[model samples]
Target: MPAVTRERALEAAVELLGAEGVRALSHARVDERAGLPAGSTSNWFRTRRALLSGIVDWIAERERADLEPGAMPTISGIDELIEGMCVMADLQTGPFAARTRARYALFLELADDPELGEPLRRQRREFERWTERIVIALGIADPVPATRALMALGDGLLLHRLTVDPELDMRPAIARAVRALAS
Candidate 1:
C-alpha cells in the first residue's frame, strides 16, 4: 500500500473531530475515515499528541491560504472592514463550518497544554497582527486593543452562531462593534 500522506491523515482527523467531536479522534479512526490501510494514520502520526499537533498546523496553513492576497476583499476603512468580517463570519458558519467546529473542539481539548496549543495561539496572534494593520489604517487611536476586542467579539459571535443559534445574523453585531472600535 502507498504511504498515506500527512495531509490526508490530518484532513480525516479534522473531519472526524468536526463531525463526531474530540472523543471520536484516534489513529485508527482517522485511518478508517481516510479509507486508508489500518495503520496508515498511525504510521504518519505515531501518537495522539503528534497527530493533534499536525492537525493544528494543517488548520493554520489552510486558514493562511484563505487569507492570502485576492482571497479576501481589500479593507480600506471601518465599513469595508466590517463588510469583510461579515463575509468571514458567513464563511466560518457556512462553507467552512466543519473546520471552524474542529478548531473550537481542539481549543477546548488542548486548553491546558501550552505546548500542544502553541500553534493555535500563534495562528491567533498572526490574525491579530493582520487585524491590527487594518485597524491602524482605519485611524483608530489605540489600534492594538481595538483589534483584540474586535477579534474577540468576532470569535464570540461565531461560537454563538455555531453552538447556540444557527440562524443568528452576525452582520449587525459585527458592524456595530467595528464602528465602535474604529471610532
Candidate 2:
C-alpha cells in the first residue's frame, strides 16, 4: 500500500470531525477515510492529541489564507478595514464553513482539557494579534478592544448560523457592528 500523505490524513480528519464530531477522529477512522491502512494515520500523528493539534494548525492556516492582503495594508480609515473583515467573514462562510464549524465544535470540546487548552489559548492570541494589526493599519486609536469585540461578534455570528439556521446570513449584522464601531 502507498504511504498516506499528511495532508490527506488531515483532510480526512477534518471531514470526520465535521461529520461526526471530534470523538470520531481516530487514527483508524482517518485511515479509513483516506483509503489507507488502519495504522497509516498513526504513522504521521502518533496520538489523538497530535492529530487534534494538526487540525488546529490546519484551521489556523486556513484562517490566515482567508485573510485579504490588500486590506492589511496601512490605511487611514476604519471603513476599509471593516469591509475587508466582512469580506474575510464571507470567504470563511463560503468554501470553509464546514471546517470552520468543525473547528468551533472542537474548540468547545477542548476548552476544558488542560493538554489542549494552552494551544488553543495561543491560537486565540494569534487571531487577536492579526485583528489588532488590521485595526492598527486602519488607523484605529484603540485597536485591541475593538478587535476583541469584532472577534466576539464574528464568533457569535458563526455559532448562531451553525446552530440555529444554516440559511441565516450574518454579514449584515457584522457590517452593522462595523458601522457602529466606526461611528
Candidate 3:
C-alpha cells in the first residue's frame, strides 16, 4: 500500500475538489476521501490555507513531472512541438482531468485571495519558461510573444474541453495552431 503522507492527503483533496467543487473541501472530508483515519488530514493541514497550499503543491508537482527533463519529448521542429501540445491536451482529458478541474477551481479561489497566490504565480512562471523553450526551439524570433500565444491557445482549448466539449479532439486543433506559429 502507498504510504500515508501529506502528499497523499493533498491528492485526495484534489479529487474531492474535482468531484464536488470547492465547497466540499475540509480536513474531515479529505481524510474521508483519502481513506485515512479520522483527523489524519487535519494533522497534516491544520488550516484552510495549508490545505489550499497542499492542493497547489499537488498541481505544481504534476506539472513539473510533465515537463521534467527526461519526460519531455524531443522537439526537432514545429511538428514535434505540436505533438507535445497534443500530449498536453491528452493529459487534461485523461488521468489529469480531475486535477485540471481542481486547478481551475483553485484559480478562482486565488483571485479572491492574494495570500493564496504564491504557488500559482510560481507555477505559471515555470510553465511560461517551458513554453518559451519550446518557442525558441521552433526558431521563433520572439519567444515571449509566441510563448504567450501558445499558452493562451492551450488554455482556451483546455477550458473548452473542460466546460463545453467533453469529446473535443485537441490534437489536430493544437497541431494547426502550432503550425501557424511556425509560419
Candidate 4:
C-alpha cells in the first residue's frame, strides 16, 4: 500500500472521532485506521496534540465551508432571518448532529488540559467570527448581540438534544429563539 498522507490521516481521525469518540484518536489508532504502519502518523504529526490540532483545523475548515455563502445565506428581514436561522439549527440538529456532539465533547476534554486549551480557544474564536459574519449578513442592526444570543441558543439546543431525545426535532425550539432574537 502507498504511504498515508496527512489529509488521509486527518480524514481517518475525524471518522474515528465520529465512530469511537475522541479517546480513540491517538496516532497509533489513526495509523491503523488509515492502514498505515505504526509510526507513520507520528512521522507526520510528531505528537498526539499535533495530530489533534491538525484534525481540529480540518474539521473547522470543513464546517466553515459548509456554512459559507451559498450554504448559509443572509436574509432580507427579521422573519426571513429567523427562517434562515431555523434552517441552520435544523442542519446542526440533523444528520451532522452526532459529529457536532462529538466535536463539542472533544472540545470540553481539551478545555481541561492546558496543552490543548490554546488551540481549542483559537477554534472557538474562529467560530465566533463566523457567527458574527452570519449575523451581519442577516441584516441585524447590532450583529454582536445577536451573534452572542445565537451562539448561546445553538449551544443550549445541542446540549439539550444530547441529553434528552436525540430524535427530538429542534426546529420549534430554534424558531422560537430566532424570532425572539430577530425581534
**If scored against the real structure, what TM-score would every candidate get?**
0.92, 0.80, 0.91, 0.75
lDDT leaderboard ranking: 1, 3, 2, 4
lDDT of 4 by residue, 53-169 (tens): 777777777776775678766566666656766676666667666557657867876777766556556666777888777567766667888888878887887777666877767
What is each predicted model's overall lDDT from 0 to 1? 0.88, 0.74, 0.83, 0.73
Candidate 1 similarity to native, TM-score: 0.92
32-126 in candidate 2: lDDT tens per residue?
Answer: 99887678788888988888988877776765554446534443566666566666566556677768777877788888886665555666787
Q: Top model by lDDT, which number? A: 1
Model 3 per-residue lDDT tens digits across residues 40-152: 88787789888898788778888878778888787778878888888878788678988988988888878878667667767888989977987887688778887898898
Candidate 4 to truth, TM: 0.75
Model 4 misplaced stretches (Cα beyond 4 Å): 1-4, 93-95, 112-120, 133-143
RMSD of each: 1.7, 3.0, 1.9, 3.2
User: So what's the TM-score on candidate 2?
Assistant: 0.80
lDDT of 3: 0.83
Q: What is the lDDT of residue 54 in candidate 2?
A: 82
Question: Which stretch of 10 consecutive residues in model 2 shows the poorest summed lDDT?
Answer: 66-75
lDDT of 1 by residue, 73-175 (tens): 8899778898899999999999888899999999999999999888888888888898898889889879888988898999999999999999999988998
Q: Which stretches of candidate 3 lie over 4 Å from their true place?
A: 1-3
